[model samples]
Target chain A: EDQVTQSPEALRLQEGESSSLNCSYTVSGLRGLFWYRQDPGKGPEFLFTLYSAGEEKEKERLKATLTKKESFLHITAPKPEDSATYLCAVDFQGAQKLVFGQGTRLTINP
Target chain B: GAGVSQSPSNKVTEKGKDVELRCDPISGHTALYWYRQSLGQGLEFLIYFQGNSAPDKSGLPSDRFSAERTGGSVSTLTIQRTQQEDSAVYLCASSLAGTDTQYFGPGTRLTVL
Candidate 1:
């Protein structure tokens, strides 16, 4: 069975603080790993898609890195606007469904 | 639609009532998806539709939940005899294809009382 697990169920950071959230997965073949940021009362907003190990993608203060067993969403100098639930998902080989992990709730206090 | 759009932004209904939620994907998008999110939980995949091909409904929780995509554009999710546990935000997303980045809608907040 394919599974995704995210660490630090919750995180608190002061404005401008930097930290990384982890998303570990167990699957036979990884097609793509997705990162999304979801705000209250809204659906997830696409952030990045990392396809292979050692691959990295970035947007503004967010950076996503992928490996064989896990992915990292590193937030640098975060602001309150960046505070939201970060979700990680993995699409297995030959499968159309995406298995998601319990997201990490981030609170950035300004 | 400019982006993925879902109808009935908020629906408060009785437990036994059946409900249908609709989604209109972005023009020219070939893939549509449905997902649910419990309070403070991550998004859960419900179904996937690619073009006029058969949909992948592997993630549906039960037989009472069904969905259909018409003309490869609009999609609707129907819940029969809603239960309290079914209350959640039902989201719809669309992408250029299965392997591409998905764009999400605001979601329909369903409440069962």
Candidate 2:
């Protein structure tokens, strides 16, 4: 069965703190890994799509790196505005749908 | 361009009432998707529509749930005899053809009494 798991269910970071969130997956054939940021009462916003192992993508203070079995979203010196639930999803080759992980709730104190 | 849009930002109704939720995907997007998210759970896939091809309905939770994408643009999800378990935030997303990145719309929060 294809499954995605995100660790550190909740994290509280002070402003300007750096941390990483993990997303591990088990799938038949990896197609793509996606990261999204969802704020309260809003829909999720697309962040990155990592298609292969050793691939990395960055945006401002956020960077996402992928591996064979997992992906990491590293936040560099995050600000309070960066606080949101980070979601991870994997698209397997044959599934044609995304399997999402229970998101990591991040709170950056101002 | 406008992003995906969903109607009735919030809805509350009796348990047995039927409900319809609408989604307007981004203009020119060829792929549309529906999902549900409970208060504390991750997004659950419900259905997918791609162009004129048959939609992937494998993710629909039950026969009571059905969706239709007309003219390959606007989509509607209909739930017959809604149950408390069906109370959730229904989210809609769309993507360009042959792409994995999906953009979502502000979800519709449904509550069953």
Q: Highest TM-score: which candidate? A: 2
lDDT of 2 by residue, A1-110 (tens): 78999999999999998999999999978989999999999999999999999999999999999999999999999999999999999988777678899999999999
Clashes of each: 0, 0
Kindly report which residue stretches of model 2 are placed more than 4 angstroms away from their true locations once superposed: none
Output the lDDT of residue A28, model 2.
77
TM-score of each: 0.95, 0.98
lDDT of 1 at A63: 95
Question: Over the stretch B1-113, how does candidate 2's per-residue lDDT look in tens digits?
Answer: 89999998999999999999999999999999999999889999998889746458898999999998899899999999999999999999998963558899999999999
| Least accurate 10 contiguous residues by lDDT in model 1 chain B | B51-60
Give each prediction's DockQ, rounded to 2 decimals: 0.73, 0.78
Candidate 2, residue B33: lDDT: 91
The per-prediction i-RMS, to one decimal, reads 1.3, 1.2
Candidate 1 DockQ score? 0.73
